[model samples]
Target chain A: MIIECRNLKKTYVADGQAVTAVDDVNLSIAAGDFAIILGHSGSGKTTLLSMIGGLTTPDSGEVLVNGIENWHQSDARLTEMRNQTIGFIFQFASLIPTLTALENILLPLSFGNRKAASSRQARDILAQVGLKDRENAFPAQLSGGQQRRIAIARAFINQPAIILADEPTGDLDEDTEQEILAVFHEYHRQGTTFVVVTHNVHLADSQESPRILHMRKGVLSEENPARTRAA
Target chain B: MQILARQINVLDYALSSLWRRRMKNLSVLLVFTAVIFLVASFQMTTGALTRTAERVLENAPQITLQRMSAGRQVDIPPEYAARLSSIYGISRIVPRVWGYYFDEVTGANLTVMGLATDRMPMGDQLHLALASGSFPGPGSRGSVVLGRAVNDMVQARGSHLLSLFRNDLSMASFEISGVFADATDILTRDLVVMNIDDARDLFRIRGDRATDLCVYVTNPNEINTIARKIADLLPDTRVVTRPQILKTYRVVFGWRSGFGSICLLTALTAFIILAWDKASGLSQEEKREIAILKVLGWQTADILAVRFWESLLVSGISFLVGVTLAFIHVAFFDAALFRPIMVGWSVIFPPFHLVPEMTAQVVLLIFCLSVLPYLAATVIPAWHTASVPADSALSGA
Candidate 1:
């Protein structure tokens, strides 16, 4: 299993009330599997994806990436794991406004050891995302779809083993959504493991042979037993 | 090599980040620069004045003896030199005549000193350099050597001879024999030197009396002992050593500079408070930016590094600009803004160039005082922002 969560649970306190964001979730995904977590708003799908990406700590569970428990690693080691093994695409276009599109794409490479030949790879990815001409434009100058495409290009610049995306197509129009899904299909065909969390149920139908899981309140359940591949 | 590249990349990002908010950072830079300028100016002026005093006093007498009467300084009898001859390790003893002359014409006080005829070529003894003409000789009784400042005052009045009222209220005229060099202007600005006999006659002192007696010691280590002996022998006399005079000058200059720094403390405190407020209170946009960086796989250390670079660039540039301006202020403009306070008020102030003194220790002191505090003030806030979990911050939880 490339990723596994054992009895994951998370509770947040809001105005002196305990809200369990993710409760007792168990899951696993193989190296090249595409898993889509479907849920409505406030259903803990984002929290579960966050735990799997080592971004948020669970109150009572273990997240293992390549069999190494995420919480057991030092902060530096975990950060390195995040940098070299996984890529994250958030719901909003989380681009640094101060940086140009090319610089934004090159940011993840700054934290890793791959410096000598990464600029060419970044340019190649920018061209792949059809944003080769917008490389010098800052996030503020780029349209929302352009910025999202640049962010997706940034994620693929590192060519990580797993891509954790939360509502990757949440706020886009249908045409741009199909374009982004097409880009995802291209990467999926190249064998990149994906864990996408979204409130849109239609996203499950857009992927190829994807294992769809439904989340309600704070629990996760598989929707289609035939599509669930054993890790 | 990769680590260096990564740091360079992050520094580039830091620079761009600062430029992105250039207006906000520029205001902070201006205030920071101003505070540094105040501190560096005070330090440089004080250092230069102290150095000038030390250099001038290097040729001063090892011990000076003056008689006291009713808590006021009275002329010591020339016979006091004979008593000092009995002391061991005494190299030379000279009874000196010098006094202050109030000039009604310019409303300034002038220092008048009588030089012994035998000490003619006092170039070595007093570090005196003549800009023109010669020192007063044995027969030049009614002749005087004027310092640059005094000569300028006299020349401005369209005269070569300086006239002053003697002790009996009679006008005495003396020819201006020479002008002291500009290099010695700080020490000789209001000085007038004449033959000892002429000085005594003008001041109306008895032939047997002198204003003070200067005692030079052959071995410097025995100066204090000799001073103590002189004090004991002449119970009503004050014996001041060269070290004591130097120490007094240092204390005065140090106190004045410290006072200047203290006066500037309010501005410095306000700036620090402003910096602390700006750092501690991160805007929602900034907090979200930190979260985005964290999600992009930057560690807390890397985030801190970016913040560190931002601060270092601001402070380093301010420090350089401030110190450079201070050097120019002290060395070229004569610290005009601080001169009245640092050098004290005078009607006939000497115009001397200060050799700007900048040492590593001084640079380090300014850095520690100005830059370190700013950097420290930002650290906790930066760490607080960096340590937040990306998911929690992004979800606004």
Candidate 2:
């Protein structure tokens, strides 16, 4: 298993009241699985994904990513895990606005151990995303699709075993969404596991798209997920 | 790499984000600029006042002497002035030629403290540069070296001729010659210098009788002991040292030190409030930006370092602008406004022309006490808000 979570729970305090954001959630994603968690606004899809990404810790429960006990690790170690073993694609592209496309992709690489953060790995990764021509473009200069594409490139830039995408297609139109999904499919074929969160019912309905899955309002359901081929 | 990496690099990020909202940044910077200007002006004025006080305490008046009687007025015959030179510490004594002459042209009335020395160390301190007229040469008669301001005034009076009164009745005329500046005493510019014989003749003081004795001690500190001993030896007369003669000034500078404190305190309080406002008013979006930076693998130290850089940059700009503008403000503007604020006319010429001291230490201290506080003020807040719960922090934006 590239990603695993067991009995995850989160309670948020607001105005002196405790509200459960994620309650007793358990999930697992293996290599070669491309799954999407479907939910509406406030359905806790983002919260669940945030916990698996180690950006937040659950009030009670354990999460392991590639045999590493993530919840038990120090913040430094957890950050290292996120940087090297797991990739996070937030709902918004959230590409560092100040950095160029190439620099943003290479940002995660710089955070972990120094091997791929070096010049050689950065060059090869940017080339892999077919973004060599657009390396120097800032996010504002790029189209929404292009920015999302750069974000997709960043997710795989460090060669993380699992990519946790929280609505990677949220800001895109249908045609651009297809292009972004195509990029995710190409990386998934290379044996990368994906746990994507989205509210798009069409994406959830496509049995050909998601493999192992769960819905925040519903429950986990294993289906014949679409298998994509690398070009 | 450490030197180049930046003290607070995230400050650059903060500023860039602030820049996207440039109008807000400009308002903040404008208020900041006004505060810096006020601080620099105050500090420099205080420094100038301190220096002027130092200058006034340094030199003795040219023709210093004691009164023959303990009473305020001395009525001695002129003939005894030349013979008084036989006394120890008496380089020479000349008669008091005149009681006091009021020069209407210069607006001063001072008793002529007659001199017999050819050249004097007391005169050198007053010089804008050295002067080369006769040094009261061997019974030199009817010659005078004018103090810088008096010389200019006398020269300005036109027709080098000057009128002096004797016995408060007879008139004496003299020529204006050389002028001196860089004075050790402010009173030096107001006194008139004349030769021993001419003074004796003018005052009609004769023989071993002079109003008072003027002493030049080889060792300056021995003046007090020498004055006491001479007072014991010459029970009829008294000895006075130049330093002791000029004792009314110590209280003025005593007032200056207190004024400097007020200036520094005002500046310090203003600085702290400005910092508190800037640090406290940071919005949620700003916090989210910092949190994102933290989550993006920036260490807590790294995030803090960035704010430090931003603060430093702001301070550096303030110092440069503040000091430069202050220099111009003092140089062109009258320091009267500051004098009332720093020490308030306590008999010191409040400095209007200030040459800025831009040494590394001054710059560093300025930054440390003033700018560094503003810059470093943001650290704990930035760090605490940065290492926040991700969801709440993000939602703040």
Candidate 3:
């Protein structure tokens, strides 16, 4: 398994009231399997993905990446895992504004011990995103679609076994949204495991062989493709 | 090595980030520089004052015998010089006649010192360039040598001769034979040098009495012993030693400089508050930047290291520029803004040049007070911000 979560639970308290974000979540994502967690806003999709990505620890139970318990590791080791074992694509294409597109793509390499190989990979990713001409341009100078393309390039620059994306297409227009989905489809064909969280049904429905999951009120359940397609 | 390179890259990014907000950071830099400049200028002035006092007192007489009656300085009989010469370890005793002459026209108190022509220190030690004629001859009574300041004041008043009213309600006059050079302005400004006999005659000291006796010892190491012996010999006399004078100078300068430091620290307190506010209150955009770094798998310590470099860059640049400007201001401009308060309220402001006494201790102190506090102030807020999960920061929570 590329990703595993056992009895995972996360809770937050706001204004003296305990709110469950994710509860008793058990999940497994096999290597090279592209999976999507479909949910409405505040349906614990992002929280579940965050825990699986090792960005946050669950209040109970454990998460193992590549059969190695991640939550029990030191923070440095966790960071190293995030650098080498997983990639993240945030909702807003969070490229550092001061850095060029190429530099933004190369940022994750800074957390790891690789510099030269990562620099070459960052350049190759920029070219792959068709933003080779805009490598030196800052994010503010790029269009929304172009910025998102660079963000996608940054996400997979490390060639991680699994990529976790949270609402990746939520901020895009219809045309740009389709373009980003095409990129995801292209990456999925390359046998990279994807655990994507999104509210858009088209993302899960469009996949020919999708392992879809539905989340509602912090509860996760396997979705029947026939029902999703009929809906 | 890879970690170091990565950190260097991050520092480069930090520089770019700071440059984007240069306008805001410039204000902090200017204010920080100003605080450092004020503190440095004050320190440099006090250091210079202390050094000048030491140099002037280096070759001065080891012991000065003054007649004191009920805690007031009185004129000693000239016979004390002869009596002091016979004391052990006394090489030479010179009876010096010096008194303060208040120049009413300029409102400056000019020191009138009488010296034996044969006994003045030669060459540069004389501190006089002989702007005009010559020192008054030994036998030349009622003849005086005026300092440049005193000469200018008397000449401005259309009088070439020094006019004085004697203690006996009689008038005396002295011819200005020459004026001492400008090089000695630090010590001799507002001074009138004359023959000992002329000084005695002008001041109306009856029957060969001099103002004080300056005793030079054969061995400098025996000054304290000789001072005690002199005190025993002249029970009603007061003896002043060079070390005592140096200590008094140190205390005076230290107290004055310490007070200036307190005042400067008041300004620094305001700066510290401003810095703390800026550091503690990270903007939404700034928080997001940290979040972005965290999402890229930067550890909390890495985030803090970036913040440390940012503060170090700001405070370090400010310190260098501030200290350099202060040196120029104090050494070259004669510490114009602070001289009046620091040098005292005298009309004759001495020409002072401060040596750059930036010892390792002082540099460390500047760092501790300015840079360290700045780093400390930012670290806490940065840690708090970094402690938040990257998922939340990226979500803009």
Best by DockQ: 1
Using lDDT, rank the candidates from best to worst. Answer: 1, 3, 2
lDDT of 2 at A20: 77
For candidate 1, give the docking quality class from DockQ. Answer: medium
lDDT measured at residue B89 in model 3 versus the true structure, 0 to 100 = 84
Comparing 2 and 3 by TM-score, which wins? Answer: 3
lDDT of each: 0.83, 0.60, 0.79
Candidate 1, residues B232-293, lDDT tens digits: the string is 88899999999998787688789999999887777787787788888989887788888877
Task: For candidate 2, write residues A1-231 as lDDT tens digits.
Answer: 777888888887879988777878777777777777777777777778888877777888888888777767887787667666777676766666667887777666443544435756666656655566888888889987777778777777677888888777777878767756666767777777888887776665443446545455423443444333110
> Which one wins on lDDT?
1
The residue ranges of model 3 lying beyond 4 angstroms of the native Cα positions read A14-18, A97-103, A113-147, A205-208, A223-231, B68-78, B85-92, B97-185, B189-210, B217-232, B235-238, B346-356
User: Which structure among the candidates has the greatest TM-score?
Assistant: 1
Off by over 4 Å in 1: A117-124, A130-132, A228-231, B67-77, B101-108, B117-125, B128-146, B154-184, B194-209, B219-225, B235-238, B345-353, B393-397
Candidate 3 falls in which docking quality class?
Answer: acceptable
Using Cα atoms, each model's DockQ against the true complex is 0.53, 0.25, 0.48
- Kindly indicate the candidate among 1 and 3 with the higher DockQ: 1
What is the fnat value (0 to 1) for candidate 1? 0.53
Worst 10 residues of 1 chain B by lDDT: B119-128
Winner of 2 and 3 under lDDT: 3
